[model samples]
Target: MQRAKFAVTLFATVMAIGLTGCGEEKKPEAPKPEAAASTPPPAATVEIKIGTVGPLTGSIAHLGKDNENGVVLAIEQANAAKITIDGKPAHFTLISEDDQADPKVGTTVAQKLVDDKVAGVVGHLNSGVTIPASAIYHQAGIPMITGSATNPQLTEQGFDNIFRVVGRDDQQGPAIASYLAATEKPKVVAVIDDSTAYGEGLADQVAKTLKSEGVKVLAREKGTDKTTDWKAVLTKIKGEKPNAVFFGGMDATGGPLMKQARELGIKAVFAFGDGACTDKMHELAGEAAEGLLCSQAGIPPQAASKAFLEAYKAKFNTDPILYAPFTYDAANLLIQAMKEANSADPKKYLPFLQKIDYSGATGKIEFDAKGDRKDAEITIFVMKNGKVEPIAVVKSGKTIPFDEFMKSMGGA
Candidate 1:
């Protein structure tokens, strides 16, 4: 009886242990929290470098700085907008180099920009500098658009990468010459040049146009770009006593030339090309600048888009001196082409740039087969009341008064 009772007890204990094990196995796991939905990581940001080259420290440094400021404003606006390319956020950087308006220095700085791996370039304000520096950019397959360089030779080189937002010297020359012939009706006109590529090339065009118009053109006069003392040259020109004189040089030299001409009693109607068309001329020549005539390769800064002018003034605390509007357009051209291509690579975006019809601060901008701005306008300005005021605009072979042109531009 005792052995049987012990067996029952052992059996009952084993059964209890088995039941406990089954209960543990059947127990439900604590409810798991729901998983959060998966999300993809944000796209990486990209850095794009755009270069601007110009005379940042010399006689025309003001103009160069203006060009640089244009690019800076464009880049800043693009960043503020949080632009994207190929699904990646794009950040633009401006790489500015000072060419000092010197061709040799221009080439050197151009190579430096190439080595810096800039996607594109915006200048080298002087044609003399732009032409040589262009070869460097072409060799590296980089695109360069000049905001102010207007020498025909720049576009005549047949480099697909070369472009300018301003009218060529050839175009500007004829426009100003025609206006001079019509307004002044001078019997004899004297042509003078600063002997740089831009100055000499423009003077040649002027002389050619004047000859075509049956105006008596005296022999071309020459001086270095640095020639501030014009007493000797003016003495020679004064002896000729031409009824009208055209000076193809920057305001720096042209201002002094005009001031000295007035002092020397040379009472000729002084006309200048885009180089000397600036408010600075008045400052440089003082009261002598009044009544002087000048031509600009593009519309005056006052004619730029209200947005651009306001932005420029807000940033720079002054109006654009010259070429800033074009440089601003040039920089936007690059950025727009990059966006269209979805890539910042020059090789990828260049074709878009070649065919782009960009409506920018200046106006509608389009490049022809030769990479020159199509239907570029040449503006005539007169120094009145201590300011350079646009008097007329020459566009598509038609000269329109400044007021009418402004109306046509929707009063921009």
Candidate 2:
């Protein structure tokens, strides 16, 4: 039996036999130099910095982290796939900042991101923050994309550098108003806003539509961004005895407002815009959140891509909050633009971003001339038994009632 047991390739075996020559020691000739062979082409790699701004430290930190995680997960997947840009292996690094939902801090961080030379940005969840922060990005010629900020002025600023993955407040505000006027048949409603750009702007739209529909807006109240005790406003709202309360603000504040309203024995049906349409809102409002109404642009988070849901759960070990899917879409859309331009520079990719027509986690993602989604739909939900249950889908001037919507889902 042969002493060597390890198998060798045919060429290697032949070379070994020739070198040993039956175990005889033969005269060794001088070793010939190896022929010059072309070396395999080296892989090219480049580091691209991406900026993400949000209220990462204040009341909405959970939602901010969710948005940041969405971008992070997208970058992670792209890096894992070895995405190449401009003939170089592109490495994406996320640089996130906390605006604390303040317009001043938002502008400060926006300039910081500009100074850091980020190729693009995804952020400033509050429209109040995004509107002011966008100017900084525009001045530096960097692209800014937001997944959540819905205030129309954010895009109407005529800044070509600003883009969003979601629909505008113009669409969402009318949706809430229509629900109250046409569907719920409420004759009197009270409106409360956080007094920020997003909240007040949306409140104005709601109030206008309500008046047009002949629904009396019983009371219009204001709250600050940092407010936690809403008793003063709730007491004033209690006196109005409106059929419903329309809140224009983030969930961090909306949740407390809802809780206080319920505790004060004000049982008006609470309706809110997308700002408070989050999983966290349901939890924060507890049982009081039940039977509550909220409207979100497009489908529910449960309706996102299955693969995305699984991957998100695996990575974060928790369900996503509102806008995470949109954030993911924004990140990928920018990367797609970069691939089309063959460069990671925003100046090179901005034009491509303006014309993208791709299906994202949120649904068909195409931007109109104003940087708003061409025709994003809206889904209204009611909190029932600790879940935000989708009851209606409104689009194309049509409203699909809850039972019919479920029937459309194969009677789910």
Q: Rate the local accuracy (lDDT) of all candidates.
A: 0.89, 0.82
TM-score, prediction 1: 0.73
Write model 2 residue lDDT over 8-27, tens digit each, in one string. 46668898988889544531
> Which residue runs does candidate 1 get wrong by more than 4 Å?
1-41, 58-60, 100-105, 184-204, 210-268, 275-290, 385-388, 407-412
Count of backbone collisions in candidate 2:
0
Worst lDDT run of 10 residues, candidate 2, spans 30-39
TM-score for each candidate, following the candidate numbering: 0.73, 0.68
Q: Compute the lDDT for candidate 2.
A: 0.82
Residue clash pairs of candidate 1: none
Worst 10 residues of 1 by lDDT: 30-39
For 1-412, candidate 1 gives per-residue lDDT tens digits of: 9999999999999999999988676432211110011112333767688999999998889999999999999988887777889888787877889999999999999999999899999998998899999999999999999998987899898899999999987798889998899888999999999999788888998899889989999988899999988999889989988999999989999999999999999999999997899899999989988999989888877778878988999998999987899999999999999999999999999999999989999889999999999999999999998898899998876788998887666554
Model 2 spans > 4 angstroms off:
1-43, 180-292, 297-299, 385-388, 400-412
